[model samples]
Target: MNDKINLNYLESYAHSFTEKVCSEYFGTKKYMSGQEIIQLSPSTQVNLMVIKTLFEKWNEELEMLKANPYFDYKDMAVTEALKEFMNVLSRAIKIEKQHFIPLLEVALIDTVLLAIDPLVYFWGEIEKNPSPFHHLKASKKYIKWHEKLFSELISKGDHADEEAYKKTLSEIYHQHENQLSSPHILLQDLNKVLPLDWDQLIPKEEILTETAPIMQEPAQENPVFFEEEETPELPQETAAPAEPVDYRTSDQGEIDAPKPSLGNGKSIDPALAWARFEAEQGGLLKGPIESLEEGIAINQRFMFTKKLFDGNPDLMNHAFKSIDECDSFVEAVELINERYTSRLEWELDSEEVNEFLHLVYRKFDEK
Candidate 1:
């Protein structure tokens, strides 16, 4: 449970995992599929799932902003910048070793922090020592809220009573589970921390560079006309155009106007793009649940069945199907209360129950 023990274990596990992946797959494949990812250790699977969830939430925010009637021309730049940022993140679809390694490293750190102590993770310690992924504006707000809540909970509880501490944390988490599950609450604000030239942070091979155009032979019967252009002449005293200034840094060591890269008319709805990408990869669904009829995701299904249903696949399937048949979230909750909760004598405030109910709520709580 100590920090050093956790850090050593994580480092050793990650090193071995990375070496296995590189030697076994990196030699031939450019991207790792979700199916392949599912075969990884449970800890790694959960970490990747966290990364995927963050990406989906980021995409959802962009879509929300893009659809606003009040969205103005000024907002368009931010929208497009976010879209491009999502694009770079979509590299996770065909995640190269270069991209995957860094992402996994950050994710593992986050996992360790959360596992070791939720209080420490939410107390702004993670924010103070941020990785690129942690430089999110929403994260600051999220941490601040949790920090206050945890502080209050600690102040009101017996510090000597570990069980009391656990009970208080669970109660607080359950009380705010709905808000905690909402995606927008954690929506990232790229303008706050991400640099204008954020793409440069990625590896050269992982960047989506524009490909060179191919030259085609022109037909002699219809030769194309070309307009000749004159080149500008430089003065003898010209000093190499002053080495082109970078607005991110100035002589005064302050940022000037940082122009984020706009989309090149290639921006598409992130949800649609992910749908196409997931289809091509033939992997389990990684995005948000659009409908219960589509069924619970593989990860969720396995997790819920194991954790809540006592590894009863049939019970899990039937419960989900029954919940899906309900016309509304209220009806779904009633059904769970009557059939599952009451019958199984489930603890409503338990983390597993809250997580399961949260996913059900997501199915019906459409924006």
Candidate 2:
């Protein structure tokens, strides 16, 4: 059955379908209405409906936040930012033939793949020795049962009855164990059940690839999958005068402010700071947190600026500098609320916002 299915052909068909949908709906229309979306094929409609529902939920969450009286002015700034974000999403988005074609292909591919081979679609390509019982796990009946079981477990939350959950699982497995068909037979039933339009798109010809038999290796004790050496700690050294680094300067040739101390009225060595900065490149910020007053790390600056401030470096710099001048976290947050949020319209619910604010808290926190 795998030999008869053409993965490439399926992918191409998905792309073609996505292009057709985009051209018909997104070409002339700025935003697709739910009424119009309902007219699309059932498979396409399912994905688009999900997107539409989520967009509605986003608006609801913003409204809920705005109505909460306990939220401070700084937190309320998120509502304004979210409103602007929604405007951009709804109005600015246009179908770019080059970019948008590939975007919708995955959803279409999943729909087609599910109709053809639910086993491979859900479990990925099975490797090594195969079991008939394993294949039965992918059957629609079993999948539905698994979903229901988990849904009940999740609904019960922290107070869930573990024994009841276990019993339910046992009952479900035993109930379906004797009644389930073989994996190959289930696959045939799935193909038969596919919508006529999709069934027509798939080619009848078989294009099989040759595969070599797997040779099992003897098991060994405590096999390590991955290994990494720990980074050596830098030795403590006397603080040197802060010197200008080439990358630390803005395009206008103004050098960044001096690095903050580690709250003990002592500055880190300039060489050590530079070395730590270099090590932190291409990864997340790590400790020992030398100083919150230090300029934002290069990677973090780029990410926060891009995600929150619309990739404007000058705006990010201005916000950071303004925050640095404030004497306390409260003042810093007030500055952000008045000057930045309304003007720049930052997305408040974003993880980047929390991360940026945490750094601000560290700056004014009693060390």
Candidate 3:
């Protein structure tokens, strides 16, 4: 099978490959007035471009992250992105509302599934349990499922051939529909399954005397684990079934690059570089943390925004809810990434980051 599939490629197709489509998709300019700073601003255009650019990058990263077995992305990219985008855009209404309203409605469905699709969350006060892998299905039973439409459109965009898209989508639909009951494919590990008493439990020194080379653990870990380590089973809310493959960073790096992308090999800002790094490394979702040491370092760096996270039980709840909806840390990072990118692009365009922060602090401290 091909290594990496760019949903961004599909994403670009879903929305026309233009800032106008993205702007119209999100209605970013809906609130602009004739005299507003956004009046004829290329910065606004660039901001929208970067936002979509990063979203696609993050989407790819989440896929890579899911290989951790300990990380999940079903909820993050599919469920959470669906939900948060809707929540963020819920207030929108415009002259073209009729046209784009369906996207918003799709967002609502995405949110509902993401929120309730939890490996197990109460729906209408009724607790239910669904396997992430099991629920990875939906298209077969529902003739009009969203995947059919998305797949149809995506294939149509690919222009493979007449009915070629349908034929391909049919296989995908069957795979997802049947993945729940599929036989487990296990390749036994020699070292892990090696009998301890092969030589009647010979001592290491004696074994070394035979000039035996040391065996090591495989780099690939099992894919598809819930973020909650103690969970008795996979979350009831699995999106799509993506197998995780463990490899060294060096090996995985080879899997990360796009077949063809827009980069021109020019020097970019360090911040953009960092944004790209996070967007890619997280792979369509969050990455598997290498060690407690690395995780702690990340947490400490994000500690600067810790205060903004305080005094809000809702926010803590929101984090968990977001994970359940988004399915992984990488998805959360994407939302944060999008917002940060938007904030930067917006601030840069308006030249108002300083002014905006000044106002925000003034009210925050009531000074």
lDDT of 3: 0.27
Q: Which of the predicted structures, 2 or 3, would earn the higher TM-score when compared with the native? A: 2
Top lDDT: which candidate number? 1
Per-model TM values vs. the true structure = 0.27, 0.28, 0.19
lDDT-wise, the better of 2 and 3 is 2
Query: What's the TM for model 1?
Result: 0.27
Check candidate 1 and list the clashing pairs.
none
User: What overall lDDT goes with each candidate model?
Assistant: 0.41, 0.40, 0.27
Q: Candidate 2, residues 154-249: lDDT per residue as tens digits?
A: 232213233332233334333333333332222232232232232223344232222312212122222111111122222222222221111111
Please say which candidate is ahead in lDDT: 1 or 2.
Answer: 1
Give the true-structure RMSD of model 3.
24.1
For model 3, the superposed segments whose C-alpha errors exceed 4 Å read 1-3, 17-141, 144-319, 322-367
Q: Candidate 1, residues 112-188: lDDT per residue as tens digits?
A: 44432343343323122223122222232222233333443444432324334334444554443333211112211
